[model samples]
Structures are given as C-alpha cells and as structure tokens.
Target chain A: MHLNYYQKEDQVLLAVDCIIFGFDKENLKILLIKRNFEPEKGKWSLIGGFLKKNENLDEAAVRVLETLTGLNDIYLEQIHTYSKIDRDPGQRTISVAYFALIDVDSHHFDGIQIDAAHWFDIKEAPNLIFDHNEMVQKAKARLKRRALSKPIGFELLPEKFTMRQLQNLYESILDKKLDKRNFINKINSLDVLIKLDEKDMSVSRKGAYLYVFDKDKYEKKVEEDGFIFKI
Target chain B: MHLNYYQKEDQVLLAVDCIIFGFDKENLKILLIKRNFEPEKGKWSLIGGFLKKNENLDEAAVRVLETLTGLNDIYLEQIHTYSKIDRDPGQRTISVAYFALIDVDSHHFDGIQIDAAHWFDIKEAPNLIFDHNEMVQKAKARLKRRALSKPIGFELLPEKFTMRQLQNLYESILDKKLDKRNFINKINSLDVLIKLDEKDMSVSRKGAYLYVFDKDKYEKKVEEDGFIFKI
Candidate 1:
C-alpha cells in the first residue's frame, strides 16, 4: 500500500549535524571530524550523517553522534535547522543541528577508531565547510543561554567537582570572568549541590571541598515549589 | 553542471507550519485554517504549506503566511522543527513550525477570501490535526519563555497601547494573573516606553495613559550597555 498523497510536494535530503561539547576542567571543546568525502574532502567539519527513512531527526542525530564517539545517553538537544537552498553545494540538504555535552575524562572513545576525528578548543576550531561555522556559532549562543536558565552545565562536568571547577565551567561557557564571591553565592542559593567532606587537593595546598549535583533534591524542589535554575 | 554526489540517501517531504498568534486586546488567539485537502480534510490545522525547492525555510514560512493572510513585513520566528516520522500520516513529511505575532485589530485579512479561516482563543482552540496540537503547545511554551527574555509581546500590540493593554497581553500569553503594580514597576524600570499624553478612553471612565515602545531608546541602550530585556 503506497500512500503517496504529497507526491507533488518537493522532497529534500535531510542531514543531522552534532556539535559535541566537552569540558576538560579548563576549556570547552568541540569534536570535529575531517570530511572523508568531497565536495570538501579532508576539511574539518562537525560529525554528521544523512537521515534515513526509518529514523526521525532525533534518532538521526543520536546515530550520527554514536557512529563517531560511540557514546549513548549523552545530553543532546536539537538547537536549530539550517535550510539555506545553497547551504550544501554538493546537494540540496537541510541539516538539523544538535548540541551534545559530555564530560571529557568520563566518556572514552573506545568504540570505533576514526583517525580523522579530533577535539579542538572551541576558540581555536578551524573554519568548517558549508554553513557549519554558522551552525557552530548558533549552537554556542544557545549553549550560553541554556547555561544561564538551566543546570545543563553539569553535563559537561564530572560527577564530583569542586566549586572552582564549576565556576571555571561557567566562565568558559559564558566567556566572561564571573566574580568568585558572586558566583559562589548564586550557586549556593540554588541549593542543588551536595557538598561532600572530601576535598580535591590537586589544584591547591588548601584543597577545596568537592560537591555532587543533587538531582533528587532539585527534582523535589521543582515538584514542590516550581524551582527555576537561573544563573 | 548536474551535481548529484549524494544520491545514496533518503529524501523526505518538508513542510512549514505557522502558529499564527494574534492578540485580540484581551486574549491571545491563534488563526487556524480548515484543511481542505485529504487525510484530515475539514479539521483545523496550523496554516502551512509544502516547502518549494527554490526557497529557504524562512521564505517558505513567509510565503505560507502571506498566501493565507496576505500580510507581509510581520514579525516571524522559526520556533522548531518537528520530525516524528509518523507526525504527518499523509507522508513522511518534516514540518518546521514558526510562530508569528500579529496585532489582530490592525492586520485585516483582505488578501484571499478563505472562508475556512477563523480565529480561536488560545484556551478554546479546537483539537488540531495530526501533531498540530503538540506544535501549538511547544510554540506557546517558546512564546512564554521568549516573552520573559525579550520584548516580543509588543509585536502583538498596536502602535499606541495603554499600560493596561500591555499588561493584559502579558497576562494572556503567560496564562497568569500578574500583580498590576509589580508589572507596571518592572515595565517602568525597563525604560523602553514613551508615555504619551494621549489616553485610551475605551476601556474605562478614567482613561489610562497610552505608551509607545521606544525602539530607538531600546536599541541605544542595547548597543551601549548590552541591556537584556527581561520582564
């Protein structure tokens, strides 16, 4: 049974591009893979793949990211769709851009060895092909906004992190120097962190106390009083 | 030159759905058109059309809106793209949903005599076709979030609107009863309104002062100090 009611409508090739963000306790980075095939072969581009008929856009995005990093259950969000007619010179393709966050030390790339894939600091990333650079800039802007309103920055941090490390993550994502006292005061007011007795002695002699994100408490607060996470 | 390098991928029909939100002075309304075509004909759905091979998504949305309402130079935004595979049972169609704000009293539909079109209050809107109800919900959520971060509610107002009218617009969109004094205080603090000597006498015996959104001042403030419009 061929149900082709929209035969007159023009069909388009859709692709999903993933802007994988990771934090290395110092700087924010993005995973980019060298395009193996032309029109711009060997150029560094966001890891992407064409959407198949059997899968939806989210599934396609997940598949594309998994095919490169071999990681699942990552925090992925569909940011925007780029549909300039000539966005892709090789063909008329509309790419749905998704941003994913991962903790650098936790997610090891042990699935598949793609020598072309490399992680570059967001600031030093080379000019990508097509409308990919635009996509990156848009994704970064979305990440910045999301960081202010949501606790998504935890996705890019380890399970147990020090206050300084968390503050550094914020500064990196926001690309601004946040006053130390003010940042700590705001985070403390959120009341979504479990301050552990253990201290991280790696950064300084008088180590800082580590903390883990209290997801249960956060959920409870949200359920009871409609808590909004704002930075 | 016929460039067909990527022929080994699936192609899907792309559509753009417009969630046309209009303010009828007191309540937020959405303009819906009855689907005259197959599968779900006669059912109310967001005004939409299939994307042509020539135009981009934004252009496609603008054309779709104009084809129905004959209005141009409207404030339009690409909200999100829906791709649930079975979202459109007519075909494997991916629809990009855009939410447009229009002043209901100002923009008279004089272009096309589409008898099927009607405006329904947001709360009283009918169950839309396919995943349209979902699209509407998402668009409304986006509108609520955007209204808090940006001064987009002004797009749904007339050139000279009373403070009460502006408050009503916000209340309608937020679906909440706001404190009048607090709301006025916040709006005044933003300093983006020019309180004119004219008054809106239609609403009450004691006429309220009409204010016009000072775009020049807002732009200057934004340019000089990166002022974020938050309500």
Candidate 2:
C-alpha cells in the first residue's frame, strides 16, 4: 500500500492551542500557560501542543486541553486559524486557536511549576509570547460578540447565580457600561431564568434573589421564536 | 551564511477550498469543480488547491478562485478547518474552508477540460466529492447568520440593487418568508445603505430605488454607536 503519490508534497506539523476563559464573580480571567519549549522558552503562552499523526484537529484540541488542564467534556469552539510564515520560530507550523468556556469552580487543575501558568485578569493580561496576544484578542472579541446573541455566558457562571453576577460578567468582557435597569429588563423579558427562593446575601444586606438558568425553557423559547439575549 | 537555525520546519501542504456562494436573479448557487486527481478522479467537488510555500491561506484561496473562474480579490472568510481522519482519501490533508461571496454575472469563465466545474442552484447542488457537502452546509449556515448581523449581502448583489432583490436574497438563503414592513424597518435602522438617485425599472413597474452599500459611512456609524442588522 506504500506509494509515492504523496511523497512529493510537503509534510509538516500542526498544533492546537486553547484559550481557556473563566468568569470569577465580577471579573473575567484567561488561563495562560508558561511556555516550556525552545525558541520561546520560559514565556507566557496559551496551553498548546503539536498534533500527532493519527489524531484529527478536534481530537488534538481536546487532547491538548485535557493534558494541560486535566478537564474533559468542556465547551470548546475552534475560533480561527493562525498560519503566518514566522508565527512559530521553532518551526513552520500552522495552529488552530480554540476558545473554551468553563465554570471556574467546576474544574480542578494543578499549576505547572517554575514555568508559570496562572489566571490573569483579561483586561490587564501581560504581553503574551509570539502571536498569542493576537489570538487572545481575537478570542475575546468572538466571546463578546457571541455573548450578545447566545446564552453562552451561563457557561462561565455557576449553575445558580444572581442577576447582578451575570451582569458584571457581561460588563467585564465588553469593557463598557450597561444600564442596570435595561440589562435586568432584557434578561427578565427572556423569561428563561427560574428564580430561587434563596438569596446571595454576601454582596448586600438586601440580598438579590438567586436564579438558575432553565436550559429546557431556553431551547423551547428558541424553537418557538428566536430570542436574542442582548444586554 | 549556511549556519544553524535557518532551516524551515517541515511545512505541510495547506489547502483552501472556497465555498463560492452566489445569488442569481432567482436562486442561490454554489461553484464546484469536478475532481481531476487520482484518489477521487471524476467526482463533483469544491473549487480548491494546495497552498504554495510563499502564500497565506487567504492568498491561496484567491489564487484558486482566480485560476478557476478568472476572478480575483473576492469577499472571503475562513470559516473552519476540516481534518477528519480519512476525510480526504488522497492523503491526511488538512483543508481550510473559506466562504467567498461573489457577484455571479461579473465572471466570464470557460469550463476546464478534465475538471467540469459548474454552478448548481443550492437546492439542487449535487452530492459533492468528499466532505465538501458538509463544508458547504456549514458555510451556508454561517452565511445566513452573518447576513443578519452584517451587510455582506451587498457583496453577493450587483452594485446598484433593488430593495426587492436584497429581500429575495435573504429569503432564499434563509428559506423564510419575511414581512415587507418589518424587513424594511430592520434594514433602515442599520443605515448602511445609500439610496441612489437612480431606479431600476426592470424588476417592477413602480421602479424600486437602487441602493449602494456605503462602506465608509457604515464604519463610522458602527464606531460611534454599533447597530445590529438582525434578520
């Protein structure tokens, strides 16, 4: 079965990088890895690895994320491909950047020692390695646009959250002010939130009522008529 | 000068398959090529090619479109990457799909001998060669979503287009009946269109006012305060 039909064409390595996004109470943070490879060794970078021959791109992304964060079955999306000639100084490689959303408290992760991997406030994140800064910027932009139309924000928040918590997540990612009345009014109109009798008493003495996202109701509402969750 | 680190890593043969989207006076059509190579010889396929070492993915996509249709500098976007194992029987090829919108009447193309490249109405498009049909479907869905938020539909239309033609393009792609007043209201709010002094008497007796897309004004308006062109 060995043949020369493919022998002439160029063969190279492909890599997958994951931009892990997490929402902490009122701020958005991205999980960044400290590089452990040559050419850009000891610099802050996204969690990434070279793709193996047998694995497809999706499988490679999932494998890299799992190997890095040790979490599986999380929400991940392939956002864009970065294929500049000198994108990776180590070699000629094309990378597909995937942005992932996860509930911060849900996943358990161990930090890589010496080589620094930690959460940075997205607004004040450090200058990243290589073209990773550009990838991060693109991922943030995609998330901001996606959050406007879909209920993906829930993925970043805990299962049960206060309306104020949800609004703060929106404000942090968009980096702009939103009218409190208008924001709450928009969310309430959607009618996909199940108000719990419990209250989040930490922030204010006059605690805000806690609410859980009703996925069934959201899907039903979408099927009946499209609803844009704009803030 | 022949020292170390100047060597390029093994480079993969990057390929770009453009889902060339076009809208005629009536239906939506996609441009395709009949395969000429050994693995899948003589099969319906998307217009595509392997990237030369010097070019970027966008450049490769443009080159393929131009060589196939004698057109260049088309409106294109990299939608997603297809790297499923055995997705391409020829080799373990990683192909990136670009969604290109073009005006159907502008290009004067002659079919190649071995490659029977042709345009088929979206409804009647044949079963494409490989994973191309899946790529086409994804591109169409992405285009439909994009048409709502952006004024890219103008790229698929003639320079001075009637309002009816614009509305029909949306309806055909989305396969939904739109109310006249509601559609007009949504479009007017975006303020991206410049109503020309001329009228197109061909479509109707009353003559719809021909409109052109104002790129500069749209950019300025979006920067000042964003507007969403919802479908």
Q: Pick the candidate with the highest DockQ.
A: 1
A148-182, model 1: which lDDT tens digit per residue?
Answer: 66565568889999998889888888898999998
Give the per-residue lDDT of model 2 (tens digit) for A105-197.
777775333235688888878888878989998998888766666555668889889988888888987788899999998888878889999
Query: Candidate 2 clashing pairs?
Result: none
Q: Model 2: how far is A116 from its true place, Å?
A: 3.0
User: What TM-scores result for chain A when each predicted structure is judged separately against the true chain A?
Assistant: 0.92, 0.91
DockQ, candidate no. 2: 0.40
Q: What is the TM-score of chain B alone in each candidate?
A: 0.92, 0.86
- For each candidate, the alpha-carbon lDDT, in order, equals 0.84, 0.78
How far out, in Å, is residue B114 in model 2? 9.6
Model 2, residue A32: displacement in angstroms? 0.9
lDDT, candidate 2, residue B22? 89
Mind giving the per-residue lDDT tens digits that candidate 1 earns over B73-114?
888888888999898877889999998999999987854626
TM-score for predicted model 1 compared with the true structure: 0.94
Q: Which regions in candidate 1 have their CA more than 4 angstroms from the true location?
A: A1-5, A111-113, A219-231, B1-5, B219-231
